[model samples]
Target: MFGGVSGKGRTGPVLAVLAAAGGLVVFGPAGGSADAAAPCAGRPVKAVGFGAGELRLYKGNGYACAVTAAKNPGTRRRMSVTIQARGSAPAGDSGAYTQLAGPVTVHAGSRCVRATGAIAGGGSAQTGWVC
Candidate 1:
């Protein structure tokens, strides 16, 4: 269940998919599917910790990104995905809002962006800032 709105006031049931698990989901505007990478697509860029969870890195569509297949434990718990452009503060992170299931895909814009995922008290994981 997502709980926030984008600046455009657009919102829906977007699902966060885990890249390592090769999960796929198709929803309205809120959810869609992305390619899963074994070692990841394109040249291995960078990767960071995604809490206790696992993550995969990839590059496609002129963008570098990290994908995760995370599902809510049915306890009303929420997972968050964030993306920060170069020189941007974590507080300025812009990405998917908190949701029940995460296949959160954070993309790098321009120079590079840092991506992160986390659950309540579950810590967080991040990716190396890259193209």
Candidate 2:
């Protein structure tokens, strides 16, 4: 019944799972599952708003994170988030998501960052850099 049972127990929180598209995806009951936190790590640094949603940034322990949060979530839609550290290649995420996208992280110790986000058909981006 589980997506792909991987745990040791049968009726004691099996935690069914499987790797898909380079990410670990979990399968749960019909309504939804628990622990569905945003994909990023660290404390929020900034939030850039757009027509459909907002781009959120976070920084912690010498790393930077980014996520695109839909203003009104629930429906599956295209979402994306991108962040680029000064003198470093950009890191980002884009796909069909129910509420948000990304959590794209990159090493950004003492460096400025620029970011962009898109949801549905709307988009937003940072014109300059910020730390």
Off-target runs (Cα >4 Å) in candidate 1 are: 1-44, 71-76, 87-110
RMSD to the hidden true structure, all candidates: 14.5, 9.0
Whole-model Cα lDDT per candidate? 0.47, 0.76
* lDDT (tens digit, per residue) of candidate 2 on 22-123: 243244433342224646777778887878888888888888888888888988998888899999999888899988787789999989888888886766
Tens digits of per-residue lDDT for model 1, 34-115 = 4332323454455455544444455555555454434433344445655455765542222333332233343445566666
How big is the positional error of residue 103 in model 2, measured in Å on the Cα after superposition?
A: 0.9
For this target, which candidate reaches the highest lDDT against the unseen true structure?
2
**Candidate 1: deviation at residue 50, Å?**
4.6
| Residue 110, model 2, lDDT | 89
State candidate 1's TM-score: 0.41
Instruction: Give the number of colliding residue pairs in candidate 1.
Output: 17
Which portions of model 2 show Cα errors greater than 4 Å? 1-39
Native-vs-model 1 lDDT? 0.47
